[model samples]
Target: MARATGIRGIWHSLPLERYTSRDNYIWLVVATVCIGAFMAAVDASIVNVALPDLSTYFHASASLVSWVLIAYLLTLATLLTLFGRLADMMGRRPLYTFGFLVFIIGSAACGAAINLPMLIVSRVFQAAGAAMLQANSVAIITATVPASVRGRAIGFQGSAQAIGLSLGPAIGGGLIGLFGWRAIFYVNVPVGLIGTLMAAAILPKDKLSGHKTTFDWWGTALMTPFLVLLMMALTEGNSWGWTSPTILGMFAASGLLLVGFIFRELSFRAPLVDMRLFKIWVFSVGNFTGLLSYLAMFGVLFLMPFFFERVLTFNSAVTGLILTAVPLGMTVAAPKAGAMADRYGPRLLTTSGMALTGLASLLLAWTLSLHPSVVMMVIELVLVGVGLGVFTPPNNSSVMGSLPSSRLGVGGGILNMARSLGMAMGTALSGTIMAVVLIAHGGVEKAGGPKGPWIPSTRYSLYVLVALSLLAALLSLFRVAEKDSSKHESMPLEW
Candidate 1:
């Protein structure tokens, strides 16, 4: 009893609010949040490079081993909004801190796993923790930071994520080569522990609402299954056959659940997601464009590995190194773009960014047949990265800025959910399109494996991505002006 009381006292005393001024303290919060962002993003991609190793180690089939990745994504996508709602009701500090702890434990479990199922389940657990961190990282920043610097703060977080994602493959490859696949999971342990302690020490206390609200169990129940089913269909549509009864049933069921979730949120007193938030043009259009941006970005990312390995005949190491150019460009540009957005509105930056990305995609497609020089290829990818870097932070700031402070949590949740959905959809659609194009040219067996129709199929996929990028650019043009978002800021919160 005495020990437990002492631990509680220590926890309470950990907050650094007494030592730091408001101005200085917010940046510390941003830095701490960046750790979570970095760790979560790193985990998302790091596991990819380890999948073949995992298969060999566990003696599992490719399909079964893939669940290790899929389960994490599925769980993360399904629970993001729910956890975001919980953060609003409970407190961001507690949820975010506990997220680090959960992630640490999950990482340890993954490292110590005896079999594939254990590792997969551990990944699901890790993703739950990641969902908590991601859902609140933006909300906490918005709630704590001044509007003037909010874009810059979010930009830092975006850069951390991009850097982590960019480095994951290289890091995973090195770690696995030196220490084996388990090292990838174990690496998270120390980082997560430090992040957990930092969060407890520096994060501001959550400001609880004055009034009590009921938890939206029905909304959660409906939304979770809906997302799970929807993501499953998207992730496995190609493998399962898009027209298969099982895929069709999952899609149909997900659609029904989505309708039910919408109806429930509209009618319920305290909804999981405030459906009315979408009524704000910035919030709605920002989210839509954000989804398209990721779709376009990830579609290119999904296709590039195939292009590098099969068409260019590059080794994995060379491909990974070349791919780093995209995120490197993003890392360089995101902070500057974010700062620019604060001075000038997101409209010009976002529109220009997507236009740049579309133009890059168009160039890549146009140059594919010409066999563009490696330098040219890297430059084009870097431009795409720069475009995404410029677009994300300002767009995120705009979406969060448009919301009442109270709705920031769920708002962030929806924003992240859109990103996850976009990634899943991007990979699925691009792969499906490439396969279809290949089939149209000749069967896969006859197409001669990456040498035959693959280049043309890839070019067609890039054209599709270019179209999506243009559409996102068009949508960005419609974003409500910054001043207009402020008008809606004080709207009463239904929850």
Candidate 2:
């Protein structure tokens, strides 16, 4: 009886009555969620800029220091589904608020790290918190906002992410230059604290699926090993050699684990992920295309800095400034694309966006030179960004729309997992291709100047990325079907 009373009191604290007008309340929720979205996005990208400085400080090999990045990404990717399931079983409000606290603590720990291992450990904690935040970001938005403007709300969230991403290089570079690499991690503490407070005060209480469901421990057990092994294989493939015994063994092990996970999910009474969700063609196709879109985007992001600094002889600062075009384009296009997706179906916009991105990549592959013009590079990146901007919100909305409210947490978790997987794959694949091609061009290691095998190898990698982008476009155009826009409309009782 006391437990029931405590639940009631916490529910009452939601303040829905205070914001009796639904429209005002909806925007407030968006405002609150955007804070977390922006901060998480910023942190993910900011660390890249600080990596070299960190390597110098720790006096570590590039491969070892890379664990700083790999550890965070690997932990975040593997745990996203688990946390999403927990959010449904528990409550998003408390979990989200707790995530902020955990993230703040992790950030402080990262900042205070005495060595690389300590920093890597802190990053693991940071990624766990990030998984909690990301797994529910879409689910919470889907629950609160009216379906009529759901796309727009999601668009604004995407814009917030773009804003965060755009600022990361600038903020990260400045912080590192001014204070040190530690300052980059320290910046999150204050921002995370504010977000935590706002989440506690402003976010509405989540209604636990109006029914009790057992947590899928068996499925989670299978999934954890599957994802970790797969991500490790992908991340280490460049250094380990694709055909090396260790890399091959990891891949084979991941495949077996994946098979086990699929079997468990299908057989389990309370599966962490409902295998049937993939049978919804829209959900499945949207997710696949979404993964491909991110793969293409991050492929360019990973490769371009090399192109800028090594080939074009630009400094890191200039390269950082130039990269802003991508996110800026995303910020500009996302909201408009969201609004458009609401009117026309997502099929046209998504297909067109992926097609455009492929064309942009092809253009870069064909036209890029040893001394590529800054204007041309910016235009290409902006086009890629715009394509992603147009594709993501609608794609995400469609995935979330296909699921019942009860399954939104798991569905969103799956969607985010695709994204994280895509990012890792893109970076790994492009990096691998470049490394192989450069190695084949024997003079690359000796040539500090741009004239060696690196330039052609970079171009060839872009060619491969173009193919991947076009393949994604084909999938979007052919596989994804037109769904009822009304499917996204707000249901009063669900909220």
Candidate 3:
């Protein structure tokens, strides 16, 4: 049946009670998921301005102090697949609820920490919860929605996340100014408590039995250590040099370990991650590009504030306003892109969106002379933002649309897991490259960091960002697959 006909049936054919009941339930569920998502995303951006404050509190070196953030990101990265698989086994509600509680405790602990090590330990707890929440949010949404409107549901989820992210920096900056860095962590506790309460009330209490969930424990065990070590190597390797015994040793271990994990998954009866999914070019290519997109996007994110504040000499408020260009562009363009993709196809949009991002990155890199018109720079960043807005939904729709409905949970899990891993790698890669290049070019002394002769590394980092964007564009080209026609109108290339 055609989508219009199908939608009409769903709306008009069903009794009013059916539609009303579902709407009430879905709205509550969406609210619960948004709470969880906001918690995760808010923290992700909130800490951007707090690193300096943390260093003073710990009386630690700036480089050492940075580990607080790095550790959290690495822990989040290493555990996404683990918890995502667990969500597949246990159920989203239990994991999601537990995540909020864990996050709350972690935040409280962070606010009270006495030193760097203690704070870092608390960060790990926070990360564990974030990983659980982040991995399951989309899976739950996808599982709950009907096939015909899955794209709209996913798009809404993405929009919520993007909105939350856009708010984070502003919230973080405002709190730090009013209270302190401790306030950043303190803020999560009350919000989390309310969310937890609402979720427990609104969510239904039923779960699918994962009779064979443990079938692929070997893959889990292998992938976890591989990512943990790999991110460690990437984030620290440049400072240590990739060829250093420590770096090379970790790299070798990660490679060997992941290879074994892949082989095990392929042979396992109930794989943790289905290796055969790769046989479908759409899933395979979509996953591949998803990783690269984060690599570029987060690299820009990791550095842009620094560029705005340190390089351009803007204050926190101005820096945030400038940074808003990225999300703002996405906000304005995404709905239109989704509408367009509904008419044509996702192929061109996916490919062109990435191409635009690469072009934007190139423009950004070329203009990093610290004297470019701020307005022009913001506009360029907006272009990259719009490109991402265009890319995410259609691509997500295509990938999910092509898969069987039963696998939406695992498939969603995998896609998000890939995204989290990409973010972790991007954070580490961008950090390491900036640190290494700055040290090589002018040393910490020349970099003139915002705080007293600090390392001004954001300029060099733009190169890394540009390179990652170019690579993302290349990967985006491989995600050309058609959605199931039975589901909706064929999406356009630009959409």
Number of the top-ranking candidate, with lDDT as the measure? 1
What are the runs in model 3 whose C-alpha is more than 4 Å off?
1-26, 52-67, 87-91, 138-156, 207-212, 370-372, 445-457, 483-495
Please list the Cα RMSD from the true structure of every candidate, rounded to 1 decimal place. 4.2, 5.0, 8.8
Q: Tell me the TM-score of each prediction against the true structure.
A: 0.82, 0.83, 0.83
- Per-residue lDDT tens digits for candidate 3, residues 64-126, read 555676677767766777887677667777788789899999999988988888998999999
Q: lDDT (0-100) at residue 470 of candidate 2?
A: 77
Q: In candidate 2, list every pair of residues with a backbone clash.
A: 147-490
lDDT of 2: 0.75
Ranking by TM-score: 3, 2, 1
Tens-place lDDT digits, model 2, residues 213-300: 5777877677777766766676567667889999899999989988998898777776766777787778888888888887787677
For every model in order, what is the number of clashing pairs?
A: 0, 1, 11
Count: clashes, candidate 3 = 11
At residue 192, give the lDDT of candidate 2. Answer: 94
Candidate 2 structure, TM-score to reference: 0.83
For residues 85-203, could you state the per-residue lDDT of candidate 1 as single tens digits?
68867899999999999999999999999998899889989999999998889889998899999979987887788889889777776777678889989999999999998999999
Question: Over the full model, what C-alpha lDDT does candidate 1 score relative to the true structure?
Answer: 0.80
Residue 248 local lDDT, model 3: 96
